[model samples]
Target: MAMESTPNIVGVDLFCGAGGLTHGLVRGGINVKAGVDLDPSCRYPFEENNEAVFLERDVNDLSPEALAPYLEQGDFSLLAGCAPCQPFSSYSQSGRSKKRGMDWQLVSNFGRLVQGLQPDLVTMENVSQLAGHKVFEDFLGYLKGYTVRWSVVECIKVGIPQSRRRLVLLASKLGAQGLELEYDPAVPARTVRDEIENLPPIAAGEQHSQDPLHIACSLSEMNLKRIKASKPGGTWRDWDPELVAPCHRKESGSTYPSVYGRMEWDVPAPTITTQCFGYGNGRFGHPVQDRAISLREAAMLQTFPQSYKFAPDDETIRFNRLGRLIGNAVPVRLGEVIGKTLVNHVRMTQGEIAVPSPAHHGRLF
Candidate 1:
């Protein structure tokens, strides 16, 4: 674990929204040098928290030659990209052709960059469903030169307090490294109450004066009544038939019960989505509170540290902007797991640590 003996891994995160992966990588022993994203708003949090350069340019605009400076600085370089995954999400899957035209191509672009730059290590995280697409297959083909490990990991299993699943991959040029993520069997899964229940109480539609991000969206008069009657883990079905939305009276809406439901305090929450701050969006209502989860709660559910600042003190907390950033982020804890896996692979490959026997070698194929 001594720093001097291990090969230096300088990471450059691509499509690095809000520097979530970069923060976790740094914690897991990788030196993240810079993060590149098209959103200019990401610059503050990326640079301020991680102390790394934030490039406000599209990944498509940058070429391998431009990234070589970061690659050249260390004995090893890591490039991680979690392309915008909406195109591959279940929400987009109903009755649509799986042959997506452009979004999947971003994964190809990531592959092209890796092919050209040949970073010593590479990683990617995305929706678990992406694995079935040809784009993912092609991306994997591009990495045939490296030892690659991939898995669909339950974020909760890795200590993220949400029932999120992500496709994680780790690749190394080093042979037989077999970079498998080892989940701790004994660690208890985190829950909603564990991560957010203790934050200073804020009334429905009220912002905590001291913490701007800890504000709730105002509820509609009917929605306020709905949430008040909602029980933890209960759906709108629990409400009196008269209180049910007219839409739910139709057969099509009967299947969509999770909307406007309260999250159970004891369980990991439903995946924190872009509209998670709204009272009627998914099952985001607070367990005992009368409001939907706040921006701060959403961020914390994604496992961003409590003190992690997404905006300057004077900036007004815009819910949609902050929600998109938090929802799109790779959970920091999951990134740490990938970082640690790569570090272990490097150490084992370089003989700094003994490789596991063939019987014990864990591979994520």
Candidate 2:
């Protein structure tokens, strides 16, 4: 239904998680052929929601020859991905260090794919910190054939409710494409309340009365008591010294209160962490309710439709797994914007459809 507005290119998503980017591609009018992810759990959601094939395998282990048939040869193919950004995540409190693991090298694996497939166009999204990382820079340099455009972008300026910043890169082999994107430097930031103020409310650890996806995590009795004592936008220090968790009372616990506290209804919520459904996680407490926000609610704030489905094994919804999937997805709307931009770039670069001769009529630009 979203594709009615435009159509042209075909795309394949690498490292697709819950089909967020893929959903945006379809909405922007591209025909998505398939999604590849090493996790089999992502298969049902990726394929069902986006209407594409899903191949389950480790990316590095797969060869271009095995991938050739799935790829479009000369029909303006786009290879897009947002590899895991945990290594570059700023909130990683473990101190200054580099991680050596399969996840860390996933970006290089992506570069390897580009070197082999050499898709007509490419796009990627990751933490803004990635801009400063050696791996990301090397990946960009490895794109020896394509012209690339990129910027570190804030999600609020683009309608995502969180204050999330991501590095967005667009590249095309057909010369250079415009890299400029507009954002309001002076615009007021979006608060969590601004996004989900009108949704039905529920207690901690309870599902909304009407929506199955509106799932919440239950809090322990003591934690519930602690949360009730917490003020909106305030820290656990607000509580009596006796109420403070022993860890928070210790030097190591000072940084954790912003999380155990309630969210201010008028202010934007903190960045949605993987543990968003838990009150003790981040500032995830509902501004007015006793419990943390629901999974469906979090997805809605992220701009995913209410009906977006993630079940693959037909098992009961696992809150931990579900939250991780939704939290990790690319915001679909942002993806749509990039998709539209790519469409415009492709049309203009090829000049296949241009201003018609006066005799032929110039109805479409």
Candidate 3:
């Protein structure tokens, strides 16, 4: 199964932000030859960590012909794309500014490329709400010739220590031999403490001098008092009346209680959004520390290893940029499961492994 000469499987990750999926795919024994993203900030981390070529081109501009040089002819060639999904996210569905109308077409573009390439294996991840859209339906219809499996997967159910949810799809032209994706974990869901309890402590407004990424965002004195009043697993409703934001007093804002809460140690952290590094953004407060979880902590919750580097040493850590990269990442664990499932399916198709053996790894068709 060694890939040094004749690769077992080679993949190209489209919209591979910071290479989280590529990292997990490599861990699961696939050779990811390249990653494609428009964000130049992702180039360093994507290439540095995954050792994969990073294409700084828009997906809309590139066709399969353009991407062919980066992929290798292997036992299996995989195309993995997770298009920017904000337009189809549940949050977007709830508001007037729902469809940006720009990024949504990327989903169709993903389908177009897949139709063009017709790789042996295909996988995609996106916010669960995507399933409800015409773009997703059209994409699925486009893959009708292939064997496909898809489901809304709760991150916690798959042992990711966060409460995020996403839709995962796996498709193969190999018929029954194509991997069937599974979203369930054999083990119990991991919690906040399970993931980050071991990191050295830092205060509300302090950065760890030893570990730069372990630095927490600073809080205002007023916000500090508000966090102090926050209880783990409790919403802003538990805060003293004086500490409550004036917005919370508004009738419309009363429904938004999950914001400005702390994560309970024994449970999975709330979804790490692009704003998670801000204390008032979500339930992103550290359980005991009077601060928002550090950038490193947020990455960990997204299933990036603590040591994963997001920027060059000389580059300043801009909160907004780094936070978006970390939050928008596909959980590495989920990607690992997808990769392992692909490997197992190929092994089974090759008759190198049996049903029971593959089942030990994850659900198999």
Candidate 4:
């Protein structure tokens, strides 16, 4: 790929994990100046992949002075924030909530940043369930001064290869702005095969020689046996009593059917869990391929480009850590949709550039 870039709407990403959103923004012809996150582990790939500089600092401590160096006085500045949401996940419904230190206050933490930086634009992405939470309400109220438009939208509607749905919010200080996303079934929704089928086959727990991101983390021996026994889209119900865990005999195991299941090749994979690398973890087993989807395939489904550079060694490839980055990303296509929307709005209101909305593509439908 060539390194062509344009000089418009330079923005900064808050809590940017591996530059997924920033990459999309750049693809839409915007220059991203910096990405800020507390995890230093993010530096390698975030810096390597995107045009932005990587800042290994907590967004909570970010002030106007800290963010000033990354900003230009005249160019349009955008503040984008996506806070960690482990506490609000469906898994948190159990006693998992107490053990998981999901800080409900990050929404307000983001609110503080937007207030301090006072960027011309603001945006965020999170799980759909956040739409009903009180924390999201407070986050919304704080952005009242801006023209706000938020909705619980599906990622597939924006051409992402996955079926994941998330709550997307776009707020601007300029004027009323909203996106009308377009999707066509005739275009063919992407499946695991569409993205990964052409690649050379590798065994479980192996990495490709040509592409490091084409790696798969190892599965334990017990898990290996369990995964072999499991069928694509089928649960452990097919396994013998000896193969079934004793906990399954107990009532607490019935609800855990998604585990140790395989993905249907024709269908969109069930939301890629952090454990998607492990065939026994979720519906991550490659339908006919025998091994689980490789890291590159997983990231591709998350809407990261095929050329994404991941963290350096297997030790850095911890499932939970990398999973949080992939699973919680704002699908790059969605981000592009946003960038296009903002560019159109800024052009229409401020005389920047004239662009067509999806309504103009009505003939395609």
Ten-residue region with minimum lDDT total, candidate 1: 90-99
Clashes of each: 0, 5, 0, 0
Estimated TM-score per prediction?
Answer: 0.92, 0.85, 0.91, 0.85
Off by over 4 Å in 3: 1-7, 89-103, 182-186, 357-365
lDDT of 3 by residue, 51-118 (tens): 78999877877888987765555777899978876554322222112244535677878888888887
lDDT of the candidates, in the order given: 0.84, 0.73, 0.81, 0.70
The model with the greater lDDT, 1 or 2, is 1
The C-alpha RMSD of each candidate to the native structure, in angstroms, is 3.9, 6.2, 3.8, 4.7
Q: Where's the lowest-lDDT run of ten residues in candidate 2?
A: 89-98
Mark the regions of model 1 whose C-alpha exceeds 4 Å error after superposition. 1-6, 89-102, 355-365
TM-score: which is higher, 3 or 4? 3
Most accurate candidate by TM-score: 1
Compared with the true structure, what per-residue lDDT tens digits does model 2 show for residues 90-134?
211222123434345677888888888888888898888888878
What's the lDDT of the predicted structure labeled candidate 3?
A: 0.81
